[model samples]
Target: MAPPTTGRLSALLRRCASAGALSPGAQLHAQALVAWRLPDVTLETDLVLFYCRCGALPHARQVFDTMTPSPSMHAYNVLLAASPPSAALGLLSRLLAAGLRPDRYAIPAALRACAELRDALLGAALHGFAVRLGLFSNVVVSGALLGMYAKAEVLDDAVRVFDEMPEKDTVVWNCMVTGYARAGRAKDALDLFWKAQVEAVNMVRDVRAVPSVLNICAKEGELMKGREIHGRMVRILAFDRDVAVGNALVDMYAKCGRVDGARAVFAGMKERNVVSWSTLISCYGVHGRGQEALRVYKEMVSQGVKPNCVTFTSILSSCSHSGLVTDGQRIFESMSKVYSVEPAADHYACMVDLMGRAGAIEEAVGFIRKMPMEPSASVWGALLSACAMHNNVDVGEIAAYRLFELEEGNASNYVTLCGIYDAAGRSDDVAGLRSRMRELGMVKTPGCSWVDVKGRACAFYQGSVPRYLRRRIVWVLDRLLEDMGGSESEDGHTNIYYDYELIRP
Candidate 1:
């Protein structure tokens, strides 16, 4: 009940930090201060760590800064680990200025801040510093450096660090995969996942790779490979026991156009969280199963799994896809009033799309005008897309004007506005817009599509097909058109989505 001595008080502070008992920890500090019983460095470190763990940064800093000889480097580590990027880097500077070399813990924490800030120069400097201090040999330090480079989009440096590491562990592997993903190298991520599995044949299989691998499979729509990975996960390990793996499985199945599979995985999971429910709802929403998504949302609420912001976004997106105007309106109203979840930009954008798609363009505009915050680019883009769909040239022009201000370099906005004018027979306006786009050096990006053939995923972009494929694919298409008794205009044209050829190897 009482901290009778310094040693006992230090232990109690650690216990409070572990339990995140902020109130009791604060009272103990007050008692220490009033009694003029200043704690030793270890006790001071414990006090700072206690407050940091409890998210009381102000209190942590106060105790840390007031130390007679300054706090230990370890004390600075605790604060930096919990502080924001700017604050963490500031503390790291203080550590350097104090002329104390940072240990493995402080280095990784500082590297994490660099990754978040995307400060590649500082991260590279830290990498050099770690090498000089001999922490470069530490597996954790290597992994942190790899993660920092990956997050900064410097994949070459990340890969070099990853390859040079004497011992590769799950942490570094996940970091590499996620780095590839964040850098838009989805195929590279999948290749690394495959490579890791091959290497793990002689070592311990890392179940941690499942989520990242599954996500890559989802993005690529490689259902066959995803299923194969699922089998391996089940046989080599009991991966279903891990909630994160289960959630990724659901997401992967859903993203790859298998709602039934996603639903089955959700049903089989022994544990569920807000993410589990939200992922299912999102898959259903994405697939235009608005009614099912709504049912799931109701079930989630009834089961006392309070809907989070993601749940609302998924459900609102569902209504937008299905044109469920009334349901969307009810849910949007309830977000702030009943649920106390303020509508984010995403939610506001979804509402505009919902109303605009349902042929209530005027109402959607009015909603945008009365929004609590300034309309984001997404909100205006949604309105512009809807106007293009409905051939509302005047409203389309207004939305396009706002979008040009918001995203001056976005070619899609210009293309959509040009389409609206073309649809309304405004040839002069279309020509002028085309001229403007050309002057701005804004060429429309080619559409890309992925094809999965016998476990191999191939990506093809418009107008970038091989000459052999184009000829053979056109010939095959012409034959199919002749067989189907198709119209003359449709014959001999490659499918717009892809210029695919089905030649046997």
Candidate 2:
């Protein structure tokens, strides 16, 4: 047989790497070494990439070090992309010492490494270096810097980098909006998004930014803004066609207490994936519409869209929340037998919650014992909560003990156990639990609630309102009470009640 050419060798190596055939890749690397007299830079770089892709970083480093004179920026980038943050930073230092000027690719990869490490100092230094080299003007580099600052939770630095950029591209705008959204600065994110829409007329808008904005709107209950974006998506025809955008729209509507809107979007989508079905199911779950959630799941399976782990989780959660014990049990069993999807720890947690909520505490404990893996804290927590509800101090104590061992720092577990003890009139147990909590320095987290008003999120603690919004808040509450046919007492006290009924179509 004729000896293989570099092209043939390269193709074979890529195939091996793509298939994750590490042994074959190694053998091919050996063959290439004997076939090539002088090292080919492209072939060597390909080999480095292959090794990196296969997770053989040491072998990749060896190949990199033995390259004829030295590796190129491309070679360094492959290593950087594959290595952890620490290793990638070390590679950046080595690249600098080797007198190789970092290019667009190398800098972004290094910045990503810094972001992963959450090393703001290193990332800022790189930003300075890029500025000195005049590469900060490059849109890709600027976006990288913005992303690094965002990931480090340094929003001020991100805003500064964004504002000082000579030109803003769609990617930079998207990064900034996403950063604000992630930092819980919803108003700022919406402002930047609207500004981008208005000011960047000549530039093509990024469709990717819509999902981040929708998520922020959903989290803050900014339904009106979410609707505006949905309208924009419809105008651009992305609402019907883009599955990801469709999923986000459904999620936003669902989380904003608008299950009907979520169903409308779900029904309108021309393309649907597992996420779409999962989102819809979860929406129904949140609204306590277990039967509707199951109907959607059936429709999803009937349409031949195979369920993934997340789909099962949503459906299982629905069953648990709505007390569909039999359905939960059947689904849990079917996961492994019918779908070949083994139950993960979360699935087990859901099953435990389902049984516990149905007043089957002993059955729930037995189910935990049969779990393929050890039960998680969430599983025990569910049992403890169920015990509290049923006043089963015996099982509650068992669950609490297991939970304390697993989640020593969780104050809620201690509180829940104390509540169970107090309800059962076990004063000594309550005192001991309280003493332990004090000794361990565990304090209960403050209770808080938030409402979106006029495009801004207002947070209230316990029973206190913000001083600036006191009058407005009181007026709104009184108006709502009057509309519900409730009047204030002679002492000027009004009572409020809440119910969990789902909004029917």
Decoy 1 TM-score against native: 0.83
Regions of candidate 2 where Cα sits further than 4 Å from its true position: 1-37, 40-65, 72-90, 201-204, 427-432, 435-442, 456-505
lDDT of 1 at 112: 93
lDDT of 2 by residue, 119-157 (tens): 999999999889888899888898899999998999999
Report the CA-based lDDT of candidate 2 relative to the real structure.
0.87
Q: After aligning candidate 2 to the native by TM-score, how far in Å is the CA of 476 from where it should be?
A: 11
TM-scores of the models, in the order given: 0.83, 0.80
Candidate 1 stretches with Cα past 4 Å from truth are 1-39, 53-55, 73-82, 198-205, 236-239, 453-505
How accurate locally, in lDDT, is each candidate?
0.87, 0.87
